[model samples]
Target: MAEHVLEMKNVTMQFGGVVAVNDLSLEVNKGEIVSLIGPNGAGKTTAFNVVTGVYAPTNGAVYFNGKHIVENYPRGKMKKLYAGTSRGVYTKHIEPTPDVITKLGIARTFQNIRLWKSQTVFTNVLIAKHMRRTSNIFTATFRLNRKEEKKQREETEELLKILGLYEVRDELCTSLPYGLQRRLEIARALATNPSLLLLDEPAAGMNPQETAELTDFIRKIRDDFHLTVFMIEHHMDLVMDISDRIYVLNFGALIAQGTPEEIQKNPKVISAYLGEQE
Candidate 1:
C-alpha cells in the first residue's frame, strides 16, 4: 500500500450562508502530483487555503504524514457542519497555522507572484532557508552561526542552479522575466525542504512555450526532490500533462476525479467546462 502524504476527509468550509468546500475528501500519495481543477468560482483556491491553514474548516479533518493537522471545527451556528459524523474530528491537536504546517513538511506558492521586490533572487530563497535555523539571535549576531549560515547559502545556491536561476542570482526578484519570477517563488518554497508542494495556478499567464517549459520543470522538481505536489490549475494542458490524478470541482463540490484521460471524458467535467450545467 502507498503511504499517503496528505488526506482530506469530509472537509468542508463555510462562511455564514456560503459553503466554500462541501464535504470534499481526497488523498495524495507520496511522490505523486495531484491537481485540483475547476471553472471559476469552483472553490479550488478555497480548498488550497483550507489545506494551508489560511482558513479553518467548518467540519471534517485533514491529515499530513499520517498525523492529524486540522480538526475540531467550532461553530456558533452551523447546521451541516456535523452532518454524517464519523469516529471523531477531535484529537490531540494544535491549531495548524500556515508557518506551523510549513514546518511540518508542507510549503506553498501563491497565485500571485510574492517575491520580495527589493531583494535579489538569491536572498529571496535564502530567507526561506532561515525558517529552520536553530541559532538564537545572540549567536547569530555574534557570528556563532557562521557555519550554519554558510551551509544555508550553499544550499540555496544549489537550489537556484537546479531551478535555472543561478545566473540571475544577484538580480532583483521583480526584475526577472515573468516566468523566471514564478520559478523563483517555487524555489523559495523548495528552500523550506517540504515533502509536499502546493502551487497555485503555476501556469497562469504563460504562453504555450513557457507553459510547456513549466510542465517539464514541475516534473523534474518532483522527481529530483521526491516531492508530492498538490496544485490548483486552470490550464488543462499543463494539468493533464503531468498530473497522476485530477480532481474537478464545481460550485465548491467535487464533481469528478480520475486520471487525466478519465477526467477529460467525464460528462460532469465536460458540462462544467461548457457551462451547460444548471
Candidate 2:
C-alpha cells in the first residue's frame, strides 16, 4: 500500500454560521502531485488554512506522515453553531501554530505574493531557514553560531543557483517581474526543507507561457527533491497536464475526486464549473 503523506479525516472548518469546509476527507500519497480544484469560494483555501494550522478545525482530524497534527471537537458556544456532519467524532484537541507545522515538513505559499518587499531575493529565501536553526537567540546574537550560519548561507546560495535566481540574488524582491516573484516565493518554501509543499494558486497571475513553465518547474522540483505536492489550482490546463490525481470541491464539500482523465469526464465536476445546461 502507498504511504499517505497527508490525510484529512472528516475535517470541517466552521466560522459562526458559515461552514467553510464540510466533512472534507482526502489523502495525498508519498511523492504524488495531487490537486484540489474548484470554483470560487469552494472552501479550498479554507481547507489549506486548516491543514497549515492557520485555523483550528471545528471537527475531525488532520494527519501528516501517519501522525496527527490537528484534531479537534467543537465545544463551547460553537456547539450551537456547528452544522457539520462529524461533530463528536474527534475526542481530543490538538492545534499547533503555523510555524510549528512548517517545522514538521510542511510549507505553503499564499494565494497572494507575500515576499518581503524590502529584502533582497536572497534574503527572502535565507529567512525561511531560520525555522530549522538549532542555535539559540543568544548564540545567534553573539555570533557564536558561525558554523551553522555559514552552512545555511551555503545551502541558500546553492538553492538559488539551482532555481535560476542566483543572478538576481541581490535584487529587491518586489522589483522582480511577477513570474520571478512567484518563483521566489516557492523557492523560499523549498528552503524550509519541506517534504510536503502546498501551493495555493501558483499560476494565478501567470500568462500561458509562464504557466507552462510553472508546470515543468513543479514536476522538476517534485522529482528532484522527492517531495509530495498538494496544490489548489484553477488552471485546468496545468492541472490536467501535471496532476497525478485531482479532487474537486463545491460549497466547501468534495464533489469529485479521481485521476485527471476521470475528473475531466465527471458530470458533477462539469456542472460545478460550467453550470447546468438549459
Candidate 3:
C-alpha cells in the first residue's frame, strides 16, 4: 500500500465574498514528485499557504502524514456566507501557526527568493538549523549547548558541500547569482530536516539553462534526501519533464489530475489554458 505524505480534503478558502480555493482535495504519496500547474491568480499559492498553515481553510481539513494537522468549518458570519459544501462535516476548528508546521517535518521555499540580505550563505543555512536545537534559553545563552551547536554547524557545512555551495559559503547570500540565491533558499529549507518539501514557482524568472539546472537539482534533492516533493510551476516544460503526476487548477478549483500524458491530452485543461473554441 502506498503511504500518503500530505492530503487536503474539501479545503476551501474564502475571504469576504471571494473564494480563493474551492473544495480543493489532493494527495501526495511518499517519494512522488507532483506538480500543480495553473494560470496566474488560480489560487496555486493559496493552496500552498493553506498547507503551510498561512491561512486556515474556511471549510474541510488538511492532513499531514496521516494525522490531521489543521481543520475548520464555517462559524458565525462565515457559516451564513459560506459557499462551499462540507460546512458541518468538521466539528472542530484547528489552526496551527507557520512555525508549528515547519517544525512538523515540512519545509517550503517562497515564490520569490527570500534570503537573509546581510548574512553569509553559511550563516543563513546555519540559522535554519536553530529550530532543531534542543537547548533552552539558559543553556544556549550560557554557551552550555556548545556540543549541540557544533554538531549543527558541522551538518550545515556538509549540506553546503553536498549542494556545491561550499565554495561560496562565506559570501553574502543575496550577493550570489539569481539562480544561486534560489538554490540557497532551498538549502535553507533543507536545513530544517523536513520529510516533505514544497516549492513555489521555482522556475520563475529563469532562462532555459537555469531552469533545466533546477529540474535536475530538484530531482537530485528528492532522491538524495528521501523527500516527497510538491511544487507549483508555470514552466510547462519543467512540469511535463519532471512531474510523476500533474494537477491542473483554474479559477481556484481543480479541473484535472493525472499523469503528464493524460494531462496533455485532457480537453478541459487545453480549454482552460487556451479558452473554449467556438
Best by lDDT: 2
Clash pairs of candidate 2? Answer: none
Greater-TM-score candidate between 1 and 3: 3
Measured with C-alpha atoms, the lDDT of residue 184 in candidate 1 is: 95
Model 3 misplaced stretches (Cα beyond 4 Å): none
Per residue, candidate 1 scores C-alpha lDDT tens digits across 188-234 of 99999999999999988899999999999999999999999999999
Query: Between the candidate structures 1 and 2, which one is better when assessed by TM-score?
Result: 2
Q: Candidate 1 has which clashing residue pairs, if any? A: none
How would you encode candidate 3's per-residue C-alpha lDDT over 1-278 as one tens digit per residue?
88999999999999988998999999999999999998899999999999999998898899999999999998889978998776678888899999999999999999988888999999999999999989998997899999999999999999999999999999998789999999999999999999999999998999999999999999999999999999999999999999999999999999999999999999999998999968
lDDT of 1 at 12: 76
Clash counts for all predictions? 0, 0, 0
What's the TM for model 2?
Answer: 0.99
Q: Where does model 2 exceed 4 Å of error? A: none
